[model samples]
Structure formats: structure tokens, C-alpha cells
Target: MILEAAMLHVKEGMEGEFEAAFRKASHIISSMKGYIDHECHKCIEAEGKYLLLVKWETLEDHTVGFRQSQKYQEWKRLLHHFYDPFPTVEHFKKVAKG
Candidate 1:
């Protein structure tokens, strides 16, 4: 499986808006092929910071398939404006698990 993580830096007062938009956007990604699951967590120590975690069957499913799909356009439209500097997404493969 592929694990994708993004550290989102939301605008000062737009954190709530970002969370709401992400909830709606999550539905779109969850319906795609090869999607395993996802979760969003907020940082208690840092305001306006969030973590987006997603699991996929393969990297291509996330990088190519999802990015190339029309759903991504909608995803961007819904959530892109909330970011301040924009999140940098990175994907990794499991090495060891307990």
C-alpha cells in the first residue's frame, strides 16, 4: 500500500472552512478506484495546522489516476483556496509495521 501525507497550513481564520471543505472533498476521493482509506487530524499545539493521511493500493492510483481524473478538479476547487503556502504531498510505502 501507498501512504500519502500532507501537512496543511491553513489561513488564520479559515481553519474551520478548510476542515469543512476537506470533509466534502474527502467524499470525492473516497469514491475513486484503488482508494483504501483516509483520515484528517488537527494539531493541538499549532493552530491552523492539519495532517491529511491517505492510503492507496498503489502510487499510480494516487499520482496519476487521481490527479488526471476530473474529480481532482473538483477537489482542487473545493479545498485549494484554504491553504496559505499550499501543502506539499508526499507518498511512502510501508517498510515495517507492528
Candidate 2:
């Protein structure tokens, strides 16, 4: 499995709206091909910061399958504007697990 991680910094005063939009946007991503699961967590210490983690069957499942689909356009429209600097997403493979 491939793990996709993104550190999201939402714009100030838009946290509530962003979370609502993300709740809607989650459906868009989870319905895509090769999607396993995902989690969106809010930071306790930092306001408007979030941690997004998604699991995929393969790298291309996200980089190509999701990103290239029309769903992505909707996803972008829904959630992308919430970011200030824009989140940088990266994928990783597990090396060890407990």
C-alpha cells in the first residue's frame, strides 16, 4: 500500500468552512479507484492546521487515477482555496509496522 500525506495549513478564520468542505470532499476521494481509506485530523496545538493521510493500493492510484479524474477538479474547487500556501503532498511506502 502507498501512504499519501499532506500537511494542510488552512487560512485564518476559515476553519469551520474548510472542515465542512473537507467533509464533502472526502466522498470524492474515497470513491476513486484504488482508494483504501483516509483520515483528516486537526492539530490540537495549532489552529487551522490539519494532517491528511490517505491509503492507496499503488502510487499511480493517487498521482494519476485520482489527480487526473474530474473528481479532482471538484475536490480542488471545494478544498484547495482553504489553504494559504497550498499543501505539499507526498507518498510513502511502509517499511515497518507494529
Candidate 3:
């Protein structure tokens, strides 16, 4: 499995709106090919910060399959505007698990 992580810094005063939008946007990603699951975490210390984690079967499942699909456009429209500086996404493979 491939783990995709992004640290999202939403625009100030838009946190609530962003969360509502994300709930709607979640469905778009969940329906994609190779999608395993995803989580959105709100930061305790930072008012407008969030952590997004998504699991996919392969790197291309996200980079190519999802990002290249029309669904991505909808995803972007629903959630992208909330960011201040756009989040950088990274992928990881599990090394050890408890």
C-alpha cells in the first residue's frame, strides 16, 4: 500500500467551510481506482492546519489514476481554494507497524 500525506494550511476564517467542503469532496476520492481509505485530521495547536492522509494500492493510483481523472477537477474545485500555500503531497510505504 502507498500512503499519501499532505499538510493543509487552510485560509483563515475558512476552516469550518473547508471542513464542510472536504466532507463532500471525500466521496470523489473514495470512488477512485486503487483507493484504500483516507483521513483528515485537524491540528490542535494551529487554527487552520489539517493533515490529510490517503491510502492507495500504488503511486500511480493517485498521481495518474486520480489526478488525471475528471474527478480530480471536482476535488480541486471543492477543496483546493481553502489552502493558503498549496500543500505538498508525499507518498510512503510502511516500514514497521505495531
- The numbered model that scores best in lDDT is 3
lDDT of each: 0.94, 0.97, 0.99
- Where model 1 places Cα greater than 4 Å from the true spot, the runs are none
RMSD values, in order shown: 0.6, 0.5, 0.4
lDDT per residue for candidate 3 within 21-85, as digits (tens), equals 99999999999999999999999999999999999999999999999999999999999999989
Least lDDT summed over 10 consecutive residues: which range in candidate 2?
79-88
Q: Across residues 1-98, which tens digit of lDDT does each residue of candidate 2 receive?
A: 99999999999999999999999999999999999999999999999999999999999999999999999999999999999889999999999999
| Candidate 3 runs further than 4 Å off | none
Query: lDDT per residue, candidate 1, 1-98, as tens digits?
Result: 99999999999999888888898898999999999999999999999999999999999999998999999999999999988889999999989989
Note the clash tally of each candidate.
0, 0, 0
